[model samples]
Target: MPNEYPSLFSPAKIGNLTLPNTLAVAPMTRVTATQEGVPTETMRRYYERFSRGGFGLVITEGSFIDEKFSQTYAYQPGLANVEQATGWSPIVDAIHAYGARAVAQIQHAGALSQGNRYRDGTIAPSAVQPRGEQMNFYRGEGPYPTPRQMSDEEIIDVINSFGRAAALAIKNGGFDGVEIHGANGYLLDQFLTDYTNLRHDRWGGNVEGRLSVSVEVAKSVRCAVGEQTPVGIRISQGKVNDFMHRWSETEAGAELIFGTLAQAGVDYIHVTEFEAWKPAFGEEGHSLVSLARKYAPGVAIIANGNLHDPVRALEMLGDGADVIALGRGALSNPDWPHRVSGDMALSTFDRDLLAPIADIKAAEVV
Candidate 1:
């Protein structure tokens, strides 16, 4: 018999926020935003579906914070202005009304800004071209346009932008919290992986050096959001540029990212994997979540990726993750949490059609 979750429905307090349960919605880019980069009705409805279905929390798709250079993809949402926030306020309010906490994930595309029409150039840790093909989101090329090497000033600017974004997310946009997009080989992960960050400055060299900017961003965001708002960072061993990419050769490398971010006052850590249950580091005696709990001590950890059923979700909680984020599972089965709690059989989701439904705007077209 599968291990039961006596505490699955139990409330978990994250930072100052008390969630209804241990389940959370991972922040995944929906790739659909209003023309001026605001939260559209489509997005609100998309998220509300999950919230109404009993998701404990819903982390919105990535919203670009720095418009000058960080607006990486076309149609990507932005938090650089008040107008966008005005559009976003309702979405957050809607999520809260349904009893689910709302969090906005702020991201900068760095070199992955394929259709990045916001500026003449983008920034990356180093100038080495990404090794993977660009997604169809950018209709123009392979890999992506090479990004400009960020100057010291530009680097500091990017870090501060994230802090400011967090402020707007809470005060102006009505978000309950914020998550730093540190994974999937984006801006923060670029600094973590050696294949991308080939710099000789304060932001590069060993694990400590590479982790500086990400940790600094967390520290800054904490200060900006104050001690009350929950803040989390997403990290993954894989990369958008290189799917098979592994940032650290050992668990020590993973520890550097996890421990340092936790020390910086991050309220939660979202660790992602192609499959959440796999061994994050072989030498580490446990899975990624186990290692996170071991090193961070008390920080809440959210694990995401391919969690297919209630049995798997229950297993993840048993594995040491404080919360489990479902992507495909939640999209197809909107009533997943309720169904699991009520003893209803889980729905069978068609993997091939999930992306469109995941991208579907339930309230508005375009």
Candidate 2:
């Protein structure tokens, strides 16, 4: 049969790692891990099915980087400890058996953490109250708590944790690479966003100061993963906690941010928005992925958010995006790539199905 989406099925490379297709499963939170942040058989099977269904790359759900305060929810996986990294080996092996590359999304919760079990208080760039209430989807309730201001030393420690976690993920967990979670209003996002970061120190004064941590984290992770392994950084204007936020109001600002990451030596930049095709700033046609490519022509771009339709996905790829990452669309239809290729009907994703993530059976994956 003729392929419906040729761009999607075409091979794409991240550093030296070549993906079988441009379709990738975006990182999604499924709190089905062990209490100690270890990946379970269920988690392994969950990701394995995505690989079998034909995704070329499987970016695992955000795994907290450190035991100190990075954990955001109960049952969330971690890459900080040896045992936790070992837990991911079987899952990576399962994905690899189907010829898919697995990448760990390493993150820190910062102020949006509703389940920071390690430390009593949450940390942020500045002691500001987080936006929005805890999402009910992740067993979170009530208003977000105000975060504690991070000291310079603590900031350095967080940056180092990202490097250590990436090293552990590749060395012990068998992951192809690591994607630093610099988006979605997490610890890294907290620093990048102006409204949240009000500190006067080196880590929080201006745009460059705000972006310093994320760029440094990428550099550190790149060093940790070595030159062969791909190290990508995820960036977004809006965040999970603050959906209406925009990091840069202008295209020039966008260039500066993306250029910084490219200069930092990241193999790829994952640009995410509510809709990847929509214009990011001045007009309705210039999308975030377009701007990212304009700024970082040397880096691969993965476009995420509301790109479920084959035509739209194709358009993004036509616009210079190397990959299309599926989130909810991939969840409902694990065989999304297969369906798109064969031109089959796609199952509609229902948010209700994720209420109790553990109960998500394979039978429902179709």
Candidate 3:
């Protein structure tokens, strides 16, 4: 079917990859992978359908970057080893064969992990306990125990891990690009949020100090992957601890974060929200997408939220979003890219088929 929204179908360049449209399947965890964190046949088939359906790009669910703070779920996929990368190669190859681009979301759990039992270490911006029930990711009872704060040397080590992970994803996994997990108060976002970070060192305190670590990590990863790979960063005002939480203290503060990222040589900036179209700041009348576009004028901006309709996604494109990334919309309808272009409503998410990937995402999360 011809697109009523031609702008969405118009080809756009995201770094070296030229995607077919603004529609993209956002990264989402699916337990379809093996318990050891390798891609399973189910994972391959699940992703293949998205590329088959019509998404210009498909970002695999968050894969752990390091063995220590990397994985938050027992069922989550990993990019740490060659075997896992080899397992994912076919998935990437399949996406390309079907005419879609593939990207990987690299992540570390930090303190949000509650139920995940790890064989090694964990770290956070501050050791302050997250406010919540002691879920399975971290193990134990009551709210999560306070995490151990990282030393200066430890922070650099993790940044190096991110760089190494990026290199591995490109060299072994065959990913066309990568997105750093900088949102939702994970390790990077945890540092950005003052409520979570109480450090007086160069890595914390004011916005610049707090944001320094993420910028350094971005620069290193960009260098690791070289200039051609599309390196994108995701930022959000909302988080697991408090959905209503804002990463920056104010709208202007949000601008500082976005603008800093823009100056750091990131190829793209992904702004996330619970609602895609709602004003990111009720007082400023700027949605996360708009604010991002405003600050990072030169970088390609992808907006993600509750965009369950193609028409709504098209509206976002018209309003300045370079791309529209579907979250649950993609999860429920593996064929979302195709169906949405034809003006189909989002598929109903299955409660039963969810335990595979959607379940236990982030260890303590849903």
Candidate whose lDDT is highest:
2
| Clash totals for all candidate models | 0, 0, 13
Compose the digit string of candidate 1's lDDT tens values, residues 82-101.
88767889888878888999
lDDT of 2 by residue, 1-366 (tens): 327677788899988889999999999988888889999988888888899989999999999999898999988999989999999999999999999999999999999898766878799999899988987777888999999999999998999999999999999999999999999999998999999999887887778889999998998898888999999999999988788676554777798899999999999999999988988874565898999999997999999989988899899998879989999999888889888788899999887777654334656433
Better of 1 and 2 by TM-score: 2
Per-model TM-score on C-alpha atoms = 0.93, 0.97, 0.92
TM-score of predicted structure 1:
0.93
lDDT, candidates in the order shown:
0.80, 0.89, 0.79
For model 2, which pairs clash? none
RMSD values for the candidates in order, in angstroms, are: 2.7, 1.5, 3.6
lDDT-wise, the better of 1 and 2 is 2
Clashing pairs in 1: none
Candidate 3 C-alpha lDDT tens digits along 1-366: 646777877787777779987778888766446777788766776777778888888988888777666676677788777877778988898888888999888887788764343555457888888766543332335665578898889899889888888888999989999999898767888888888899999999999999998899899899999999999998888886678986546778878888999999998988889987887776558788887888887899998998877778887886679989988777677677666567776667655555423453232212
Candidates in descending TM-score order = 2, 1, 3
Q: RMSD, model 2, all Cα superposed? A: 1.5
